[model samples]
Target: MTIIEQYGWNTVWKDKWNGKYREHEGRDLLPGRIIGDFGSKFRVITETGETWGELAGRLRHTMTDSGEYPSVGDWVLLAVQDGGEHAVIHGVLPRSSVISRKAAGNTRDEQIVASNVDTLFLVSALNDDFNVRRMERYLIMAWNSGANPVILLTKADLCQDAELKIAEMERAAPGVPVHAVSALLGDGREALLPYIRSGQTVALTGSSGCGKSTMVNWLSGRMLQLTQDVREGDSRGRHTTTHRELFVLPEGGIIVDTPGMRELQLWEDEGGLDLAFGDISSLAAGCRYSDCSHEREEGCAVLQAVAEGVLEEKRLLNYRKTQRELLYQSSKEVKQKRKSAAAAVKAGSSRSRNSGWRKEMDEY
Candidate 1:
């Protein structure tokens, strides 16, 4: 197979790159896929095999933030140097799907977890780390990612009520496939093979100790990633996978495994929320008011459903909470943009005044 094909490249991506980046036409630059991303450097796999790459000085200068840099699943054009030991990245192809979240901590910055994923495995072990509320949040982000999200309930060997947990996950995420798999026991892994067909790419992500690494190891049939046991007191595992890396699966596909995330803050648009909570949104259509808040509102279908035991009140409450958080973040981003614009204008005006003063003094 061709190098690009091995990295999950297809005709659609080639068309997109050629149509948008016409400048690369007839150039000697080769196309490469980024499989590993360090803070300042990247590991790209091209026709020449794997090579370390760094952004060209010009590309680095143009990048306004880390979000613009090459991510693990990005397809980029590279200028090979030093006989294939190193390369310089020139451009990045448009992404088909992206999994991102608000960066951990106070910053409102968006951190891209993975890009160009065809399917996202939303894993949650059935052990102590399982929480329906957290699963709901992950589902919202997964919907926003533009990739098919398949919920995986791992560590089924440990949980006594695996079927019960799977049912709950199905309820929390309607219309999404939920598979209960034990990586250690090799159960339910074969069912996931269809999603990992040739030329396809899947990403595995979940909370720490949720068996994401174990899933990677099991699927790949080797110790590709190290797995540490969760603490006895608290089911949290150490960050065994410190960096994101893409692996070419023996089963004829690519899989990007990311470090377990402790917190999954939403950084998404309204459409994602609507799709993630389609059940609630469908019920909202039956509300008496066109703009019903669904909280203590008269004739609110959502509240009515909750009251009648048709819908879980916790789901409705979480939906509203996410909506409020999205609204607040959107407003905050707008204000920050306006403030930056004002500062730019003031800086320009001051520079102009100083230049005029300098010219007058020279004339005198």
Candidate 2:
């Protein structure tokens, strides 16, 4: 296989290039995968070799959303220049899967974590940072990402009840694979190997100081990333990974390591909430009222399940909380869209009036 093929390029991608990007081929444009995204620049790996790339002016101007720009793991068409040292990215291929979250702070924007990922490894340290509620939030984004979600309880050696934590996570994320791994001791790494075999792309994401960088170094069999100790008080590790990067393993497979997120706000939930909270959805189906809110409602199966100890009250509360967040986000997005539309109309009308005045002045 060629160099690009090892990075998950296949005949399907070639066919896509031929069908849509054929024109670029004649202009010395080549297909490359983005391995690193550093704000204004990108590190892309083509068959020729690795090169630094920046978006072409036209492509940059046309892309209005942050998610629309090239990110780590994106396949893009680029023109190599400066004797292969630099490149100009022309376009990005359609992504098979994308992981996104809300941009930090009060902004109604989407941040694309990674694109074209096949599997998402949600890592949480088994220390004080371990929170099942946080894991549930990650699961919602994972399910929405079009990638298979696998929970990785890291730093197992630090925790006395590693198995218990794994079981708890399993219960929280039904139908998803859960494993406890100690990167320090190299235990439980074997179970994760299958997901990182040749041509497979797996992304590791979790809160900062959760052992994602350690896992990357261990899996790559080298110190590909720097590791730091967590704070003694809070068990929170400093942000070891400052950016998202794609690394090709020595043996085979691919891994995308991302910086720990301080805040994980929901972006857009398209049935991800239901998938992440499958147990609650399943219980809700038996409610007498089809639209039962499960809060003080008669014949609410969900409430009954919680009361009878079949479901944890905390879990149900988290489900409701995430549901509310998604609803509120949706409303804000609708309002923003309307506001933008009105501004666009007003701007167009002003432009037309100005143009008419200019024409009248010229005729006069």
Candidate 3:
């Protein structure tokens, strides 16, 4: 296999390159995978070698949103430039999977975390940093990304009741695999090895100070990333990994380590909420009313399950909370789209009026 193949390049990608981008082959356009993203610049590994790359002028100008740009783990076609040292990315391949979240703050835009990921490792430290609710949010995004989600409870050594935490996570994330890993003691590596073998791409994500960087270093068998201690009071670690970057593991397989998120807002939900909360979804199916909201409604199976202790009330509340958040986000997106359309029409009218005025002046 070539160097690019080690980074999860396969015959499928080859077919895509030949079928769509064959015309560019004569112009020295090569297929490469993005390893590092530094805002405007990227580090890509092509068959020839690793090189710095920037988006082509046309690609940058035509991009409509941040998610369209090349991020870590994206496969892009590059044209060699500047004595073969620099490359210009001309096109991004259609992604098989993409992990994204709502842009921070009030913005209603999608921020693509990584693309073409096969598996998403949702890591949460077993210490005070562990929050099942946050894990539920991650699961929603993970299911939406079209990648298999696996929960990894890290820092098992720090927690006295690691088994209990693992059970809790299992209950919270049904149908998803959960494992407790202790990076300090180097335990639980065996359970994780199956997912990290040859040609598969896995991305680790969680809030800051959750042992994600430490897990990366351990999995790579080297200090590929820096590690830091969590604060004594809150158990929150400083942001050790500042950016998202892809690393090819020494043993085999690929991993993308991302900076810890302070808050993860939902971008959009395409049946992801139902998948993440499968138990609740199953219960809702039995409700007398097909569109039962499960709040103070007669014959609501979800409420009945919660009351009967079959389901945790807290879990149901979180599901409802996330459901409402997604609904609100959808409303905001519609309003934003309308606002943008109006602004665009107004600008076009102004430009036309200006052109007509100039023409009249010329006639004068």
Q: Give the TM-score of candidate 1.
A: 0.94
lDDT-wise, the better of 1 and 3 is: 3
Better of 2 and 3 by lDDT: 3
The CA lDDT of each predicted structure is: 0.88, 0.91, 0.91
User: Candidate 2: misplaced stretches above 4 Å?
Assistant: 24-28, 358-364
Error of 2 at 161 (Å): 1.5
Error of 3 at 173 (Å): 0.5
Total clashing pairs for each candidate: 0, 0, 0
Per-residue alpha-carbon lDDT of model 3 for 1-364, expressed as tens digits? 8899999999889888886785574676789999998989999998888999999887785664435788899999888887769999988999999999998887677899999999999999988899999999999999999999999999898899998899999999999999999888989999988889999999999999998998999999989999988998999888898788999887688999999999999999998999999999999999999999999999999999999999999999999999999999999989988998899899999999999999999999
lDDT for model 2: 0.91
RMSD of 2: 1.7
The best-first sequence of candidates by TM-score reads: 2, 3, 1
Candidate 1 residue pairs in clash (backbone atoms < 3 Å): none
TM-score of 2: 0.96
Which has the better TM-score: candidate 1, or candidate 2? Answer: 2
Write out the backbone clash pairs for model 3.
Answer: none
Query: What TM-score against the true fold does each predicted structure earn?
Result: 0.94, 0.96, 0.95
